[model samples]
Target: MPRSHVALACLVAIFWGLNFLAIHASLEQFPPLFLVALRFTLMALPALLFVPRPQVPLRWLVGYGLGFGTLQFLGLYSGMAAGFPTGLASLVLQASAPFTVLLGAVLLRERLTARRALGIGVAVAGLVLVGISRGGAGAWWPFWLVVLGAFGWAIGNISSRLAAPPRPLELTMWMAIVPPIPMLALSLLLEGPRRITDSLADSLTAQAVPAWIGLAYTIVFGTIVGSGIWVWLMTKHPAGVVAPFSMLVPVVGITAAWLVLGESPHLLEIIGGALVVGGVLWSGRLVAARGAADPAGPVDVGDPGASAHAVEPAAR
Candidate 1:
């Protein structure tokens, strides 16, 4: 990869990694779902207005958007709201990488390799370790919701691969537009208009600065810049190089949570986070090194056995 592209990739990683903190900060007052809906609503602005719509099948577009944008966020935010800690959520969501690998096997008829399976095992073990340690910290069920959200994101990954939108940034932009409606509907159904209205009202009156900062960080830094840079990076390099950086999110997540919220990880959680990051790194290096060795091989991404290609084009 060119130095500029590498720099861009690193920047995207930083933005995304910092996003865990952004989510934590935002969830302070905003109901997770409502906050998420507000996030997408804010994100859709310039994209809906300025970005050209991509030409793709409507179902693919809708499915990709809702699966990734709505369902994934719903599960993640709800999980966090229910009790899953920020650092833990960061670790569990990496399951989406392995989930995408499995999804590719089933949906795209992609082959699974032993090494990738091993990486998955390591990552899962790490998650289990973290979960066990955190058992007393919160409800287990919500953490499962985050896992489900990872699965939903994995589904979106397969859908994106199948769709292969001609214009990835445009696709991302349009896809981003899909979340606000469903999230709004969910918020209305679950929280009721009264609660949401009260939250918003409170924000306007006294001040919900954390919510504002969270919303701004997610909308501006997380979605727009992060997704845009990711799409651009994929255009310049192979997916394998891009996917591994995702593991770093938890590093930033844990550190930021500790700094901002005084949320500390237990020894087990720390050890688990290390294993998860190592697994992801091992998976990434495996593919990248393999691709370098094979003269005729095209680089791949998403597969621990291979590389991560599922969201290669959307790593941001």
Candidate 2:
């Protein structure tokens, strides 16, 4: 990657990190499921109109949508609404990285070396500490929901690997078309027509301006610009060179939440988040080193989400 691309990678990380604050803003005015529906609906329009459909099988695209777009955001938005902290949401969502490693080994039949195993174990331990910290407050369920979202993200990553679309960015866009209908149905079923109407009605008010802006930010920067640039960089550089920059996201997330949303994390959460980032970076580093040692190394796709975030450490 060129120095300019490196800066772009960091820019993507900042956009994604601040995306947590945007989600929180939207959730203040929109139902979580409904937000999921609307977010994707806004994104899906481009897919329907402008973006070419990825050449992968239909099932893979749908699976990518369901797992990455639908399930991941469903759990994520729901958890945030249930009072999961925003900074931590960014941290916990990273569980997808380790989950990807595990799923790749079991479902994809990829080899999991001892170093990878150690990394996963360390990451999981960090997660467990974070979970325990919340459990001490008897509000652990929301934490699990975010973790489930992370798992959903991992599933989406697997689907992306299987899809192996020639245009990964198009795959990202087309998958957006999957979430709106299902999530909207859920919103109608769970959030009710009255609430949906109320939320929409509320959107016109001056108080709702920030929420609308946040929504636009998420759709434009978070997905289109952020993920688009990520996939572009992935296509251009080795995954190892690209993957480490992703670690910056939580740093920005936590810092932004603290500064903007006034979210001060628990000591345990800080420690745990450190472990999670460090462990994931460690695992990614080992994978890159191994690949560097052997340029003929087989490709192993890894990721946070096909939407993640994009290019996995093992993709090289």
Reference-based TM-score of each model: 0.85, 0.86
Clashing pairs counted in every model = 8, 2
Q: Write the per-residue lDDT of candidate 2 for residues 1-316, one digit (tens) a residue.
A: 3456668988988998999999999999999999999999999987899998888778778888898889989988999999999998988887776776676666655556676577667878988999999989886989989988988877776776666667778988998999999999999999999999999998999999999999999988988788767656654543334544666788999999999989998999989988887876776665556545655432343332342223233432
Query: CA RMSD for every model?
Result: 4.4, 4.8
In model 1, how large is the Cα lDDT of residue 203? 87
Name the lDDT value of residue 172 in candidate 1.
Answer: 75
- Candidate 2 structure lDDT: 0.79
Instruction: For residues 31-126, write the lDDT of model 1, one tens digit per residue.
Output: 888987888787678777888877766777787777778888899999988878786787788777677667666654455567766776787788
Poorly placed runs, candidate 1 (over 4 Å): 1-9, 136-138, 231-242, 292-316
Residue clash pairs of candidate 2: 302-312, 305-308
The positional error of residue 101 in candidate 2, measured at the CA in angstroms, is 0.9
